[model samples]
Target chain A: MTTAKRDTYTPETLLSVAVRVFNERGYDGTSMEHLSKAAGISKSSIYHHVSGKEELLRRAVSRALDGLFAILEEEHACAGRSVDRLEHVVRRMVEVLIAELPHVTLLLRVRGNTETERWALERRRDFDHRVAELLKAAAADGDVRGDVEVRLATRLVFGMINSIVEWYRPEARGASDREVADAVVRLVFSGLRQG
Target chain B: MTTAKRDTYTPETLLSVAVRVFNERGYDGTSMEHLSKAAGISKSSIYHHVSGKEELLRRAVSRALDGLFAILEEEHACAGRSVDRLEHVVRRMVEVLIAELPHVTLLLRVRGNTETERWALERRRDFDHRVAELLKAAAADGDVRGDVEVRLATRLVFGMINSIVEWYRPEARGASDREVADAVVRLVFSGLRQG
Candidate 1:
């Protein structure tokens, strides 16, 4: 049953609806029927915009990955001292994640159950490895603590940054994204103890 | 399909099998048939051990929650100064999490889609609230920093701890549990920057 609104269903908008459904029902659990219903369109209309749900997933994750990878090319991320650049990247990651919340959330939840998911997983690891290298460089510069291994510190820091998606609601009037990013920087660099 | 090995399938052993399958396939995605096939037993034989998959989920999460709650009742967690007690609870949390990785992993992934999952999520919030209280007390005592809000600090720290399940493998031959816990404690109190 195609409605007159079918004219409004561009591939980008359809991908947005698909990502929300995927986040709710899970990438593995969601079917095209669910996507069509959530999108208020027929399955064939969805197919007309994109090849399948997997293409929608690929598009969604690619958007998130592009946002993240773009941060590394920024001047602050590339030109500062290792620790400073690391901080810039961390702050930008929070901003990017908040700005692209749904897409990144979907990207984070992929479990490599399909070819598209596996590709997303591989890119995620590459992104993580690049960040780990920054941490390692900081350690070598004696700017960061040496007691914790670079790899372990990288994982824990990413863990702290990523877990923001679990509780952050832009509508909640809680901490602003800037405030949250500030708190993360403070905690990651100076920790919770009184100085 | 009930073999002579049916005699070997106690409720606890069967619960273990069910939990592994639930973790892999997700609780909503798993069916009784999946559990039975994974356990190498017939559906009725599996049923003899528990009421259903929900019972298995309840049992698994209860084990994890109990381990965490028990940490609060310990002497170090209860009897020391607030900051010390908070530290004790944090260390024990890492230990308990590593010891009960699969159960807690399953618990962390719960989305409240079912009554059992909703109960688990509620209890998890209760647990988080209790830890937040300790951090509040520590800040009141001037032992912890006051700039970051207690609730936000509690969440960031827990996020770092809870994310341990995503990558930590007991077989990885990387950091030992003690070392990992020590790193977490140091990172929380002192942070990544060098003096």
Candidate 2:
């Protein structure tokens, strides 16, 4: 009710709260009223920061996509032999996903319900195709297995990576991000079987 | 509605429609009215088969859980060398996931909202624990790498396997169920790298 309390919420802090609510209630289920309640601010105060829930979603998913797309532009991802470059991208992906867990979680769950959601899906497909092309190049280089179809391998590897968002908790005294990235890279390239 | 139209919905057929709607709208978002409309029956007609929407969720998750648990009970999973047994379970997990795609899809998306959802989450944990134990046995046998923690490895492997539900479409011409099962087994055991 106080102006001081209402004015304390920066857009970043508000976005963090909005993303959590969206993740919990689902974007479609979450309303501006829910955001206001969760953020402990007036609905008008929330509108002061962003236009609506869709804008928050756009911000969140764009952040996730940017992190992922940035990996492909990195030096390691670009300069190595196709398989090594693919491995670099995979390792960077785990790091990016863990770093941006809540945002990426929201990104992965968008089911094309709204225009923003559909745009997120389209960007996601573009990211997938970029990685799939990397897998194809690796296969053509005879560095990765050619027996498995490139598209299927790409999807399965992505499945392994993206599933990290489901259970990973940074605050939990579990594996460090480095340990996880190493494990994912090893499992993706070397299998679980002992060498 | 005509009597014949209402009478045509068996519990099995009604459950199918309910699950499809549940997957599309999500379990929490879906209501009895939604199920009734999706099934082309009255809400009372739905109640004739089961108690409510939660019952449909219970039934769907139970079906998915039943398929996964059945994999661990198979002879190959029980009697082989620890690594080989783990491999069998991984392959069968992919198969069960594909065979019961909608059921498992709904199962994976449950967020412990209601008693039924919480129960499903518990059962999923129990299933994960069972698979983790198999991975531990394999690591102890030296058939699989020991550098990665047993629990972490089990999760990543399951992540790779369980993700099949996200994108696998049996009706699609891309890969047969057999091809997918084979690809999963190969990736889990041998990895994406060529020898």
Candidate 3:
């Protein structure tokens, strides 16, 4: 992905580099010197682009949170039966996750030790609760199974979707985003046993 | 859980404190000082039990990997039809994850920066491949759906299962291990759509 020739480092470009290192070394583990080395820029130049490492973290997570929150506002997310709407959100989440892979990966790994991390975590919870409500609505409508609690099911479904960040490499010969998303929706609704 | 009266810090007890700190602060970010502080022992005293910070990480991941690999040896995991065996493994994975919550959480988060972390990542991949083969066998039997690639399906299911580390608080008012396992099996094999 980095093969495209680039001459200058924008704050956004610097953030992309910083996010990768943060993911490699934990956010708390990454230092300005590390970011400077990864981005091939000096420490002073990095300060010129963003306030510091915390600002970069805030930007990266904001990008991820924006992607997730946008899914809730889409026409498909709002205009269908609760189950169908939930399915739309799930499928879109996979697409968004892959598209914004690194940012989402960092978002999932945040521990609330710092102020920025705490904020990111709070936003993540709100997104989760929103998804949980959709599941609860589907269960109440009897369009989805009631035997499994909606809250637990929501977390597992998110778990399955989010785990893609750990394993999905864009260059690898894995299934397309849509294919993985379909499997998730199917597995979430059906039993593994052969009929 | 820690509310129970405790006496002295054995290597095992010190390890429990270390793992929690590792999870809270990423492994790379944690210092011997942090471990000492969390363990309530002086740095020199902590060394009396274990070698160093690396020792704690190594011990924690070993415990988690042992639990997972042990499941493959169970009679049910070995003797049943491929699909059933796969189901057995999947169900047991949830149980083991919940049973060794902190250890497994630390295992999943390893990034391979250090030698010990590299070993953990390699073993994690081996365990994943073993589960993938069971999934492949089931797909061959036309037991599990062939629509999704087995590798991707295996990852998504593992993603769902491994995600328990993120939120499966043993003390939380959450679903039982069996409940979570049943939901995973249902989601992995059948899916979310109503019959």
Say which candidate scores most in lDDT: 1
Worst 10 residues of 1 chain B by lDDT: B1-10
Window of ten residues with lowest summed lDDT in model 1 chain A:
A1-10
Cα error, candidate 3, residue A52 (Å): 3.6
Residue B37, model 1: lDDT of: 89
Q: What docking grade applies to model 1?
A: medium
On lDDT, the stronger of 1 and 3 is 1
- Give the per-residue lDDT of model 2 (tens digit) for B26-111: 88779898888888788988888999998888998999999999998999999979999988998889889988999999999898
Task: Provide the clash count, candidate 2.
Answer: 0
lDDT of 1 at B148: 92
Local distance difference test values of all predictions, in order: 0.92, 0.91, 0.86
Candidate with top DockQ is 2
Flag clash pairs in model 1. Answer: none
Candidate 2 lDDT by residue in tens digits, A1-195: 467877688999999999999998889889999999999998999988999999999999999999999999999999979899999999999999999999999999999978999999999999999999999998988999988998899899999999999889999999999999999998889998997
Can you write out model 1's per-residue Cα lDDT over A16-132, one digit (the tens) per residue?
899899998898889999998999988998888889989999999999999999999999999979999999999999999999999999999999889999999999999999999
User: For residues A71-94, what per-residue lDDT tens digits would candidate 3 score against the true structure?
Assistant: 999999999899989988988899
The CA lDDT at A183 in model 1 is 87
Judged by DockQ relative to the true structure, which candidate is superior, 1 or 2? 2
Candidate 3 lDDT over residue span B47-126, tens digit each: 88888899889999999999999999999999979998998899899999989999999998898899999999999999
The residue-by-residue lDDT of candidate 1 on B1-195, one tens digit each, is 355678778898888887899888889889999998888889998777788889999999999999999999999998878999999999999999999999999999887889999999999999999999999999999999888989889999999999999999999889999988998998898889888
Deviation in angstroms for A60 in model 1? 0.7
